[model samples]
Target chain A: MKEVTVGIDIGGTNTKFGIVDDAGTVLYQSKLPTQKHADFKDYIQELDSAIKHGLEQTSSDLQITGIGVGAPNANFYRGTIEHAPNLVWKGIIPIVDIMQKDFNVPVIITNDANAAAMGEMIYGNAKSMKDFIVITLGTGLGSGIVANGELIYGFDGFAAELGHVTVNPNGRNCGCGKVGCLETYVSATGIKRTVYKLLADHIEESELRGISFHDLSTKMITESAERGDSVAKAAFEYTGKILGSKLADSVAHTNPEAIFIFGGLSLAGDLIFAPTRKHLEANLMPIYKNKVKVLPSGLQNQSAPILGASSLVVDHLNKKSSVNI
Target chain B: MKEVTVGIDIGGTNTKFGIVDDAGTVLYQSKLPTQKHADFKDYIQELDSAIKHGLEQTSSDLQITGIGVGAPNANFYRGTIEHAPNLVWKGIIPIVDIMQKDFNVPVIITNDANAAAMGEMIYGNAKSMKDFIVITLGTGLGSGIVANGELIYGFDGFAAELGHVTVNPNGRNCGCGKVGCLETYVSATGIKRTVYKLLADHIEESELRGISFHDLSTKMITESAERGDSVAKAAFEYTGKILGSKLADSVAHTNPEAIFIFGGLSLAGDLIFAPTRKHLEANLMPIYKNKVKVLPSGLQNQSAPILGASSLVVDHLNKKSSVNI
Candidate 1:
């Protein structure tokens, strides 16, 4: 029988789940509004039904293997999601255990970025790479580190937090109660802040000056840069300088074969990537220069998250014996 | 029969070799001046003779297992030392292949910092720890990263060069043709530079003002600090602050359980540790607050390096079958 695994992505607004084959094909998929159920029980009940429905859509010839979940603040070792700010659920939720009780299968849970890394290793560009890093640039920067073919889940099972690494000591005040975080300068929201700073710094006026802070989006900045707005172009340069320099520092720690850029900000193409790549090369130590590849994520937006989440189950199964569930 | 492993530490001035048991006990030890042998062949010949002499002291019951060598710019995969600035050996010297020809055993090689980390794991405070970092504050700041109980040897076999990581972008010029490396502000040489900068900054009457830049030593600064010298004390504080803050950045990448301060500067005890521990806690993100420990290396001066090098052999042996040699 053809083996199929369920990949679940639990986002704050929407939860996307799918039944995927070993070849990374999404056989059946469904979604549920996560915020509608503030109560943990209600959320789990709906999630259980959604997953069951996804399984039912698959043919009888297909054998269900296990379930893999990607959520904010998810812990692979404990299989729990602890105080994830984005999610409605507060405190520590034993998500894997709860899912396992209903599904009776091996339920592996890791943070979203980590799932993306596993997906890259199993089904994306990092299939042959043993050491590589995946950076997700969204509202906040998230990272997943893979070394020696294993996701680095340090002692606490939350090892890779590249965003929180202090890039500037006295630079910007971060929401994490820290100053000058890499995420504060390079992420989607970070670029907006940069645009405002650039607008104030340079006396030359641009189209971005008309837009309010809340109204501004990364897409708007990209459009502005394409239109030859000096302020918007300068913002990308500043952001790339910080990100590329920080990535050079990370290269010293893990020595990744490649650093894959993912998420919305990455979609900006060469506008963001060109500067980042230039600064990364400029800041790198002599030996590391020209060796580490900085590339875009191989997985596409619509299916990448599900693809990554699904690979988590396949990755686990390949390592251990099959669970009865 | 009791099995023993040979641990060799190759330094610029001298080479220290020792026979150690699995229990981390040093049975026999000796040293040779490294720079005397300009030719690589002569150095290996002397090394082989030294090992033979050390083996003669052992009884018939003592069976030699394998040899592990720790040196600058050593590659674990290639078992070669490549372009080590400190050493007289210039190009790639396949030390492991040469030693294996003589000793006929599994001769393993790695950089000294990595050896120190393995030593800490097998014999020091990190025996219980699966994830931790060891920062060696010598002439240059060196680091060994252990995550998931394995040393992070990235794609290039040279991953953990924490010293070269830029702490300040425009801070200080580094020997590696980079600006503001952590080593420039944290090591023995780094502390001396800090003292000089402080002397220039502060006009207060101080004994350090009398000492010329060339006449100064880390030991003298330690003595000056002991005598309640404000300038010397300030240097340690400044160095600790930079080291601690940069260490916080490293923690974001790996989330190590503890960061052990090793080597010469670490000998300053609470003077260095006190400020480093303080700033580390202060700079740590909220979620990581108080979770990571900053401790001193448990192994004292001589035994630590040897113990670490010996552990490399044992570490390799534990994973593989017996070496034919």
Candidate 2:
């Protein structure tokens, strides 16, 4: 019988789940609204039912092996999600424990960025690379560090909070109650804020000037920049500069071979990668110059999240067997 | 016969070598002037003779198992010392290969800071720590990062160059050709520079005003601070603030359980520790705050360099055996 693992990605609004084989192929996949159920237990029950439904639709000869999950604020060590602001659940939720009780197979979980890093290592561009970093540029900037051929969970599970590292000591206030965080200048929301700042700083005529702060979106900014809007272009340049310079600092810490950019803003392509690479090279120390590469995530855009979450199980099983050997 | 490893620490002025057992004890130790010979081969020959002489003084039953050398710009993977500014050797010196040819035992090499970190993990305060950082505050700020209970060698052997990380974008001019590196603000030389800047900025400084930049030393600054001199005291505070804040960024990257301050500047004790700990706690993100301990190295002062170099052999053998198992 073919062995399969269930991969679940719990986002703020939607939770994506899929049945995946060891080769990272998605057999069956679906999504459920995360906020529809206020209670975490109810959400778990619905998720279980959905997964069961997905498994039934797949070939009957397939046997379940394990479950791997990716979520914001997920703790790999504790198997809990703690105080994730975007999630409806207010406090710590024992998602792994809940899943483990319902499923006979092993249940493992980590933050979305770490899951993405594991995916990269297992089935993406980093398959041959032993040391690298994955930066998820979604609503908030998230990072997962891989060193010595393993993910660095640190002393606590929350090691790679690259977003919260200060860019400016007193620049912008972050949700984490820190001022001048890297995310304040580099994430999807950060670029929007930068666009607004650019509009106020100069009298440049652009498409972004008409849109209100809440109504403005990263997609609109990307579209405007592609059409030669100075404000939108400046926003990407500014964002990339901050990201690139900070990544140079990250390089001094880990000295990774390459840094992969994942999630929403990465889709802007050269608009973001160009300035980031430029400034990163400019800011690096002489010994590190021209050595590190900044690249995009190799995972397919739509199925990337599922693939990342599912790869965790395969990685864990491989590690387990290797340790046994 | 009892098995022992030889540890060699090559410094700009002196080269220290010692015979050490697996129990972290120094069996026999001695030092020789490093820059006496113009050629690296001559230096190596002299070093080999010195080790042989020291070993002759030790118990005759001791059998050589391995040799570990710690020096500036040492590379673990290549086992070469590359472009060490302080060393007489102008280019890459294959010390490990040379030593391996002379001694029919394994020869390993890494930078002094990494050696110190291994020493910490094997016999110092970080014996039980799986994740921690060792900051060597001597001529320049050097760091060794330990994550997942292993030293981070990075893609290249030169991973933890934390001293070169930018503390200020356009601050001080560093010898490394970088502006405002962490070493410029936090190392022994950095504090001296800070003292000069403080003396220039404030007219209230009395004692340090008489001292020339070349005459000034970290020891003198510590003495003045101990004697309640405001300029010296303020220098400590300013240095601590920078070190602490930058360490907050370090914590964000690796999330170490503790950060151990080693080398010369660490000798100041509370003068450096108090302000650094306070600032480290203040600048850390909420989750990491109060979690990481800013502590002093557990290795004894005079013997630390030798111990650190020696620990590398034990660590390498242990890892090799574990992998074999």
Candidate 3:
């Protein structure tokens, strides 16, 4: 039986959908604008349309087994998208009910970080790993913790929010209204904030002098680093130092086998990797030093979110038979 | 079939053990001097004698299904006690293999903290909880993390060393050679240290000054607090404040349903509880405050270590079928 699953990776800007098979292949895919709807009903309608069109491209009769969704603030237990900052919707939206009604299949949803972790476990380099941490340092620091080959969704399906954990009590003001959060100092926006601070305080000549907040991006920082811009390079080093030390602290708690880095800031390669490794080792306990490996996510480019979402459905359905009752 | 298990809890000064049934009934129990043997093998023999006598006392010939051992620096995967600080054993001893040879029953081993956590899950307050952190604040701080209904044993089976984690980088020197560990501020020894510091600096009049470090203990501190000794009460207040804040950080990471504290320091009652609860709630995120319960261990008064250790063996043997290939 060719079990096809509808995988939706919902972002603030766009929602990407893919019709994936049981063999871990994406047979067809499409993208839709996310912010086009006021109530998000139009968004789901578009997603239904995308899945319908994608299914048509498959040669055999494609029986969509279920639906899996990955989005910011998606609550697994409630099957709803909770107060997600990026989304236009203000309150809870029952995404599962909507998706199931449209597709007539079992629907599930989880936070983006956990979905990415599942994707890595099922379809990426983390296949052989039983305990690994999937860290997505995009606009925010999102972490999906895998221990004993299962996602650690705590009592309320809210666990592994590494970004909100304090790195410094009085360091930086986080969007979460906390000070010195891991996310405040390590993510893409965090790097930009650091760069701006450096630009304002230090006397360095660089191409990013006049760039506004909207104009600047992690890509620009990477390009500047490649061109020997000391300020841009310093930003990465500072950010990575905080990240590395935080990783050491994290190791003390979970002792994960490896940490997988994915998302925007991670694309900086050595700019982020070198300093992170150095600081992580310096801060780690003697027993744990250099024991945990840092690796890049196996999914290429933008395929991660989609694959991660789909992986949830695939893994969950597989494990459903375990309950004897 | 009626099955029983032997649970052994090894401490620096003494060892306690019991024969425990499936319903958590302690059929027979005893305590013996841990210093009975200079040789590791001798200690094992003594433990064997204890277990044999305990089983014989029970009427029905219940099959001894398993043996559980808990000690400092114990390793679950290796089933060995390695270079534990207090144990006179000079090197790694495969205690599980030694025990298995005696009865041909399954044997399991874990550190003391993990055993306590297992005891909580199987026989104590956290029986209904799958996500919780059990912190033992005795001579030192020890944490056992339970996530997704299982103990999180890391790659080296040495995960959940929350005490050694840096809560403050420059605060205090820990026995682990680290600075500002949570244990250095919250454990029984840590509380006395806080009392001395308060005495030396605060210029407060108190009965605590009459006592020497040789006789001073957390028990004395609680007594002084009950007698209205300003410095002694302040020490516990200070200890609770630090512990609670550290726990708040723990909440941010694991988001556990509850944090159960056991051991001497927790015996101070509201002298420790009030400040801890206040500070924990003050520091916790809005979603976690009031939602996350910080409570004392239900097994606080009982000789839980041996029970916990015994529970480990039972839990391990119970899970054997899960890993059956």
Candidate 4:
């Protein structure tokens, strides 16, 4: 009869949900195609079915807490998904109102990057970290900044757009109509471009000899590097160094304890970690030269997002319960 | 009579203390030579004498709430001055213990920058702001970051070291043994150095005619800019532009409501503000562009430190106060 919270992590193409307990244990989990429908209500219908199935799996006596959702362009204060770039939903989606009606409990929503950071704080390797930047190197680079144990939401609840920050003023063109963003050099798209640029400059022979950017993937490159492929290894080493140098400069701004890396491209392991540590140390000020540590997130793949989303519910309920009692 | 808190602000050469009420009204304020003492304990004795004099000025009915101190390298967690580079203190000074024993009340201590940020948040122009950065651009840049209404103290209480963040990578030498730190080109010494560099590069410069780095002061240049001196005006414009670009990058990291400027150099007004605003808006991302406000502190120059120090006591007492009692 353990109480449960339904946590939903919304992606552009897929939506994942899970029932989590007080001790951060996931009792049940499932995923569904998110982009199958044209309108936002169809996605809600699919989400409703998933919640019902999750409730059926638990005992009747098991109490339900609240629902927490993590999505792109989610606003915690307004409780809406405003201008979610990838989703077909044209306007603000009143997610909190709809969720509250179905669950009969509190509903909390926040941007995906923020949710990931909270998840790391609550159930991952960054449990005791107060100031740290969580970087997700996926299709596009996403960052969550935790300062003073709370997420930074700017005046319009749009802070921590680290991907859009110019890393090299004239280096790369980003999808966000910016030049040389951190993501433009660190994301999956970013690395492939770097590989192409490197290929054009170097006469070195490798298995990536004639691979086009369309056929390339981060997983393939990581596997190739694990097999001692030079080009794949170079791709990670160069990417990690660039990211580490910028991160070193960023570290001095807030002097965080450590940096946590997750998502697809970060899984390159030694190829990424070694150069990142080297360049970070090389660029660090004496006060923070060897002090800040960089490490991989410990949250198990799919579980991380859901747990982070669940933490929103836990945080919301905790605030409400504390206020009333 | 109402309760009053004693506020102390310690600088390299001078130490100032004042008795302040809840409204941030300074009843009595005085200063002492800070560098005269050999051992740090001697400084404590001198501060104690000043507090005693102030307490005697008022009746016993005027209850002394607590003492709050703002100094370099002060840590709120440990309540110790850990390696204040400006002071000759050999090791960590136990500041809170001495103050508490004298007044028989609670005492709190934090760094000067954090004190300023809190001062602005509670009583100054930035009172309503939850996210803001306070820059004390004087001998060096001292920044205090407030996000979500709490000052950012990282895992080890060394967060918000914005001065040391590298800007040029190979530009100028800093006291911290780093090159191209933001402090190198934006502080008092920083501005002077930029003027000197510009003088060296220019083939036709007349007004800044024979000024050496040591001979030129930030005030002298600011005065020149006010009177239509091109070189002096150029220095300020360049300084503000660089600062604004850096600020834009900072905004991307943690979008704040506004960035507040204070301390000696910031008094230049429009000379610094205009260029900073122009460049900041130009460099900002679309979501944050033209939205974030930049301003100066509203606390009176003399009372800001005192009230800010007192704020530490208020915040501490509020957090630790009992629920039922």
* Candidates, DockQ: 0.83, 0.86, 0.66, 0.67
Clash-forming residue pairs, model 3: B7-B310
Candidate 2 lDDT for residue A87: 90
lDDT on C-alpha atoms for all candidate structures: 0.90, 0.92, 0.86, 0.83
Q: Chain A: TM-score in each candidate?
A: 0.97, 0.97, 0.95, 0.95
For residues B1-325, write the lDDT of model 4, one tens digit per residue.
7888888999888889888888878888888988888887788888899888877785565777888899998988898998778898868899888778777898888889888888888778887888898888888898888887778777667777888877777778889887888889898988888888777888666477777667888889998888898888889999999889888888987788899998888899999999999988877878787788899888758878888898877767666664333
Candidate 2 residue-wise lDDT, B279-325, digit = tens = 88878889887899999999957888888988888888998998899
Candidate 3, residue A232: how far the Cα is off, in Å: 2.1
RMSD of 1: 2.2
For model 1 the local lDDT of residue A97 reads: 88
Q: List, residue by residue over A20-136, the lDDT tens digit for candidate 1.
A: 987888988889898898889899999898777667667767777899999998999999999998888899999888888897889999989999999999999999999999999
Docking class of 4: medium
Off by over 4 Å in 4: B58-60, B321-325
DockQ (model 4, Cα): 0.67
**How do the candidates rank by TM-score, highest first?**
2, 1, 4, 3
lDDT of 3: 0.86
Indicate which candidate wins on lDDT: 2
- What candidate 1 gets wrong by more than 4 Å, as runs, is A321-325, B321-325
Q: Which lDDT tens digits does candidate 3 get at residues B1-325?
A: 5688888888899888888888888888888888778987888888788778777777557788888888998989999998887878878989889989988988899999999999999889999999999999998999999998999998778889988777777789888776788888889899988998998898878998999987998888999999999998889889988888778777776779999999998888899989999988877766576988889998875668877988887677767766563
Query: Against the true structure, what is each candidate's TM-score?
Result: 0.97, 0.98, 0.95, 0.96
What's the C-alpha lDDT at position A269 in model 1? 88
Better structure of 1 and 2 per TM-score: 2
Give lDDT: candidate 4, residue A131.
Answer: 82
